[model samples]
Target: MDSNDVRRQWEARSGEYSPEYYAYYGPNDTSDALRCIFEQFLEPNASVLELGCSSGRHLSHLSVHGFENLAGIEVNPDAFDVMAETYPDLAAEGEFYLDAIEDVVTDFDDGEFDAVYSVETLQHLHPDAEWVFDELARITSDLLVTVENEGDVDRDGSTEPDVNYVNDDFPLYYRDWNTIFTDRGLVEVDAREGQRDTIRTFRTAQ
Candidate 1:
């Protein structure tokens, strides 16, 4: 599907995989892991941005852990409503952009954020907008991380088609997070594999 079509579909999603739906899940292991990474590598005031922060669930974890500067890009407008209702503290404190990541991220200046991260978000980026990968690298001054279900069909996910459709709808693009960012001028500093996600952290090479 076209990138615009993909954005529209995600923007309209509700009931399941929607803002409220994901908000219901709250903070899980992924959330804990992300918090640990931040606490260890960054100061509490480090500027952080989440690529697709549905209802601000993960960001809420960071907020509660004492990270003050936070922002998020989410396509679903209802996400802000749900976030305002659920994570009121985050909603009040966080700078949120209610638009697709592709659109909002471009306006950011180079090295605008101290740290940038995404949770299962980049995989959904349509190939047409894959250039946003470079933009992601460009905007983060200190650190960049990706926690994603990087592959489904195999260990390296090398054999699967470039684009995998989920439940006959939406697109998930398989990518090597380490290779992608490293090629974009970041250095892969840490990597770990979970049952569902591959977490990779990169630093702007000194």
Candidate 2:
């Protein structure tokens, strides 16, 4: 699918997600775990960019934790609209562009951010778009964090796009981070395993 198709898919599912589901103010395990990871890997004043920042939840959470330099790129305008309304402060203080991940290289300078991260994103990218990784590497100066679905499942062998848990018709691609990032000159710094997904962190190889 092309970028337009991707955008429409997300837009179609926007109504199903609300500010509460992506709330940063409340206590939740996902937020708690992310906070811990951020504290560990990201500097307090780090210039952070979230590649697929749906509704700006992570940015809001980062703001609450005193990390001021935060920005995001979200493809879905509806999601961005919700984020802008909910976290006006973030919308005012940081840049949130409605653009696809593959186009980020043109939108930002090389090494524009100290760290770049995405959670429960990336997997939804069109399987053929491996160039997104190169763009990600180009724009990140220090670290990269990705939380994505991995491992074999009942539908593991299929390479076709299908409806996922969120009811979006997007194809999921499980990547081998070790090979992908390492080939792009990033080395694994940390990794944490969860039941169905994994969080992998990487840094530029010195």
Candidate 3:
């Protein structure tokens, strides 16, 4: 699917998503493993950009922890609206662009952010869309991180029964990090496997 199709799919399910969607990663409510890992790499004032930052939950967490320069890009207008309305302070402090990751790179300069991270976001892109990786790397200076389920499960339509919300007509594209990023000149620095997904960190090869 193209960018417009991806937008339509997400826009259709935006209203169904809620703050509770991030219950698994919430700072005080659940496991601090993810937060602890982020703290190790993200400096206090790091300029961080979150691709596909739905409802800004991670951005809010970073804000609470004193990461001053936070920004995000979301394709769904409904989700962006909810984030802007729910976290006005963070919305004001940072930039939240309503645009697709594939097209947002033209809006920023090279190495504009200290780090660019996405949690369970890249997997949603079409399997052949490797341009997304190059664009993200272009804007990131120091680090790139992705948290996703890596496997051969390719299914399209509503999400599985485990999710609290309904993400309809969405295509799942699980990518091989070793081939995608490494082939593009990024070296994997750290990788932590979880029960459901894997979190991988990368930097431009020296």
Error of 1 at 144 (Å): 0.4
Work out the TM-score per prediction: 0.95, 0.83, 0.80
Superior candidate under TM-score, 1 versus 3: 1
Error of 3 at 166 (Å): 9.3
Write out the backbone clash pairs for model 1: none
Residue ranges of candidate 2 with Cα displaced over 4 Å: 1-4, 17-27, 153-168
Residue-level lDDT tens digits of model 1 in 115-190: 9999989999887888899899999999998998777555454523377788888888887777788889999888
Name the best candidate (by lDDT): 1
| lDDT of candidate 2 at residue 182, scale 0 to 100 | 79
Q: How many pairs collide in each candidate, listed in order?
A: 0, 0, 0
Q: Give lDDT tens digits, candidate 3, residues 71-116.
A: 8888766665666677777878888888777777667898898888
Candidate 1: RMSD to truth: 2.0
lDDT of each residue in 1-206, candidate 2, tens digit only: 66567656754563444443564443345555667777887788889988778778777878888888988887666666777688778778987777777765566788989888887777777655667888888888888888777655454545443435344446566666666787899989888887667888889765
Top model number, TM-score: 1
